[model samples]
Target: MADTHENAYDEFAEAYAAMNETGSWNAHYERPATLALAGEVAGLRVLDAGCGPGILTQELTRRGATVTGVDASEQMLGLARRRLGGSATFARADLGKPLPFADASFDLVTASLVMHYIEDWSVPLGEFRRVLTRDGRLVFSTHHPTMDFHISGADDYFATYQFDDEWFHGDIVMKMRFWHRPLRAMTRALGEAGFGIDVIDEPDPEESVRESEPRAWESLSTKPAFLFFRAFPRYSA
Candidate 1:
């Protein structure tokens, strides 16, 4: 099911990029969190896993990081290379499989707006830990379980369960699998994946977001639309 959704993205990469450039489609929520988690990327070896159109990759490069962006969609990578120029390298790879990089290769790794589609996130989280240098950080964001539940027409936001939803934006249609995990589940997943949580931020909506999409912004400000986390590889003395 996940693979089907991924392949669908590969087919609609162009349309996706076009819509995303406007900062609509939850861009205001995602971009700020990426920037906050990836502070001072200068001189860092960074990996942008599941990089959609390479916008975040370009941002990391602009901050002086040596960034490598990877995605399963060839079309997306092609668009990334075009927009990013030669500033960063872009590769095609699957998120469900072991990352193609060697152990201890990166100082930081990030995957923005990419986890909800994954059924078993622990696999890639463990793989990410394996590729990080000791003390390297992994920062990623995902749709808030509460937000997912609300958007999916679920009546109860406090329900402790998974909910399935389908999103349709014009011609692009895909199914989403959401895990409505409480904070405990998130921390436990990080611990089991050999990472220690450093920070978990649920930011308020910016003014622009508030003005542009008042209802969404208001809802998100009160209840987070997304969750961002910074985690570091666990060290044993």
Candidate 2:
């Protein structure tokens, strides 16, 4: 499944970034959430898992972290390398497989807008816990289930609930997954993966973005844009 998505991303690399730049897709969707969870990256050894095009990776570097970015798409990594220059390290990796790094290797791990594409979050979550230092943190953001309910297919928000049980975004040609689980499911998964939940935020879309973008405000304020979380590797029994 990850490979299928990687192949799709390889084909969409140019268009993906262009769409993001032109607002065909919302670039800011995950930015504020990721930054809020990261706090300060200064001097940290950061692992940017599923770092498509390195947008957040570059941001991490700017904040003084020594960052290494990994993604499945060679084309995406190519773009990341070009944009990031010598500022960070880049690697080609598939998230479905074991991450190719030693245990207790990183100060922090970040996965932004990437978890949804994965079928089993536990596999990589466990791997992330394994690679992180005892005190290290993992932060990530994913689609909100309610938002998924609202946007499934109906043009009107009120009309969408009839189609609730279906995989709302399943038919989306682009490779994506939607986890509409309640908060308890997420906390349980993290606990099963050896992580302790530190923070879970459902940010109000209006407040998250700069106030000048009225269109962004209107569209997002009506719905939750994302669910972000910060988790730490459990230190003791």
Candidate 3:
């Protein structure tokens, strides 16, 4: 990752977690859409990579998956531990480096809104492939290039680079950095990392959001706010 901020969420763990719990984009949109692609996680061993505050971990476990959450922020891990207790395992690990797991350790791996933080996908994608069983699928969600490019006001759509933004969680303001690359680059990175794309989705927000947050529902349903993918290893080792 070029603009490395390993503990980016550490300082705002509490505020972020609180916001994530019921945030229109997260709780109602991204999480639901991502989990739908995950399909039947029941009775499966899953890795929730970059699992902040165990939000998705809790949902995965609730759906009968044995979940292990990993993140670079110790503070976020603390919140995850407190939230899930013995329901899921957690460790402090950076996605830019090797993951601490044995080969073929999981049946599924999810990296929700996490990959954009790392400029390079090779290391983490390889690690995810390494840890997944032969039949395992990697399902993830990330910022849509269209959205990023629009927000960044970058001249070249094909260029891969980093950008900065600010997030507001209640009264707390968090400055964040993220990577932006064209759609082709994302797929290329997956192919080079030994994954074969099975599904590429631009999802609509769940119906529930229509009543609660009509504006977000309308915007998310019509626009490309995020991109989702479900891929499996191309050649099993």
Candidate 4:
């Protein structure tokens, strides 16, 4: 399949960066949960996969992790590079293919809200497992399958399929495609990719959003939009 999300992110890089800076519930929710699930990142080596404008990458660096950011979009990486300056390294890599890093190169890998764009998880998930040290943790978030299935009005939730959606921020609008897979399918994918799941969380909204973005908080507090998991490599990645 074509990489539509990468193009959308690239075309709307500036707008997406501004939205990420807003600290909205959607923008901020998964990061905090990923960090908490990760325990401590200080002094750890981190790879922020699908880094996108470097939001999570900068945070990992600020929290004292030696960080590297990777994305397919050079426009998005440009924003990340400008925001982080020399503090973090940014690279462009397609997640559908093999990653460039050596095996066990990272102590922790955080992929925030990126996986839904990929239809088949085997290669990308294997790549994540490959770069992680034996005991290193991977924390990632994706569009909740249930929620997407509901919105898609699909007859079979178990069937993996792609759908189109629009993202709006002020005057910037972008169309994107996302793949939806059932939880069991994801569990099977993880198992097949040589990783053991640690935590599966449908966490509450981040507290900061309660006052700053009450509507988003109200919507997200009761209905989780994203699903998160922490896993470690079980066999060879």
Candidate 5:
């Protein structure tokens, strides 16, 4: 059987990709925030982990990063390959397992709204650290714990657990699962994986969305929809 973590994306790859292309939450909110955190990537070796549909990968490559995009869903990878067309390399790999890259293989690693799917951060995070150069950084975004707890209606904030939810894109609806852990737990996991946190951002929706997506702008501006982190490897002396 396929890993339950990845099956949902394969089922709605096309629909989700279409929606993500113009969706206010993705285009104006998460993607912009993530790219801002990445700063200048020209000439950097970037690994776009969980690079669904090549949306972020295309932008990274355009900004002069030699990117390698990886996703667990073949359907999504196919979409990515078609979208980029030899501009960047593509791979099929799961963040839940050891990444298929050599140590110090990349200058930056980016995971956009992908980490929440994995219940255990140890293996994936360690893999991120292992693949990144000494000076490299990992930039990622995920569903904010508080928001997820509210959406999940879970009683325990400190405990780590998976919750199921459904996503609607146009007329297509897909069920997905995500793991939720408290703020402390998230930071602790990163520290245990040898990453030193540099920035923890709770971004507001871009002003551009104010007129076009007023509701999204209002909600995201006032509440924490997602959390972003920029972390670097910390080696012991």
Candidate 6:
């Protein structure tokens, strides 16, 4: 049986990829900020956890990093492999499960806008630390915890729960379920997993969006919906 996250994307691989290419807020906002945070990627061994459709994975390879892209949904991985060709490796692996890589396999790890699909962070964050060299950095973007109310209209700010919402892709609207955890919970998990927080950023939307999609720019600039992080393994990578 497929889990919530797997089912959501597996049924609509091309639709999701199309959104990431053009319509989704991630296309204009989240992805660009993630790449910006990961400056100067030439020759870095990169592990792109939850690398849906390989968009960010492709960019990392373009910047000279050798990358491995992993996703839980085989359908998404299919699209990713087709897009990435041999520029990067593609694998079907769940981020919430034990990663297939050996210890200290990468110089950089990135998970772009994928964590909220997970209900628990401890194991995955631990795996991320284990696969990274001592000097390796982890960069990621996730939905802002503050937007739970907007996305689900939940009254309690501190409660953690699941919510389902309809998102449109061209003429298709799909129902997606994801967990909403408080920021404190995420930070605690990161600390317990042996990562030291290097940066916490509430970044603005990409500058081009301001001119091309003013409504999105204003909405995001006034009340951002994504949070970014840079973390390093503290004890040992």
Q: Which candidate is the best by lDDT?
A: 5
lDDT of 5 by residue, 37-146 (tens): 99999999999999999999999999999999999889999999999999999999988898879999999999998889887889889999999999999999999999
The local distance difference test score of model 5 is: 0.92
The best-first sequence of candidates by lDDT reads 5, 3, 6, 4, 1, 2
When 3 and 6 are scored with lDDT, the better candidate is 3
Instruction: Give me the overall lDDT of model 2.
Output: 0.75
Q: What CA RMSD would you report for each candidate? A: 2.7, 5.3, 1.6, 1.9, 1.3, 1.7
TM-score of each: 0.86, 0.82, 0.96, 0.95, 0.97, 0.95
Tens digit per residue, CA lDDT, model 1, 78-128:
999999999999888877888889999999999988776665668889889
| Sequence-dependent TM-score of model 5 | 0.97
Q: Which parts of model 5 have CA positions greater than 4 angstroms off?
A: 1-6
Q: Which stretches of candidate 1 lie above 4 Å from their native place? A: 1-6, 24-26, 153-182
Please give the lDDT score at residue 193 for candidate 4: 92
lDDT tens digits, residue span 1-237, model 6: 133643888888888898888853877788888998888899999999999899899889999999999998888899988998888999889887899999999999999978888888887899999999999999999889988657888987687888887888778877888778888988898999999998999988778888888888889889969899999889752
Taken over the whole model, the C-alpha lDDT of each candidate is: 0.80, 0.75, 0.91, 0.87, 0.92, 0.87
Clashes of each: 0, 0, 0, 0, 0, 0
The ten-residue window of minimal lDDT in model 1 covers 1-10
Q: Cα lDDT for residue 169, model 5? A: 72
Model 3 stretches with alpha carbons more than 4 Å out:
1-6
Using TM-score as the measure, what is the rank order of every candidate, best first?
Answer: 5, 3, 6, 4, 1, 2
CA deviation > 4 Å runs, candidate 6: 1-6
What lDDT does candidate 1 reach at residue 189? 79
Cα lDDT for residue 68, candidate 2: 93
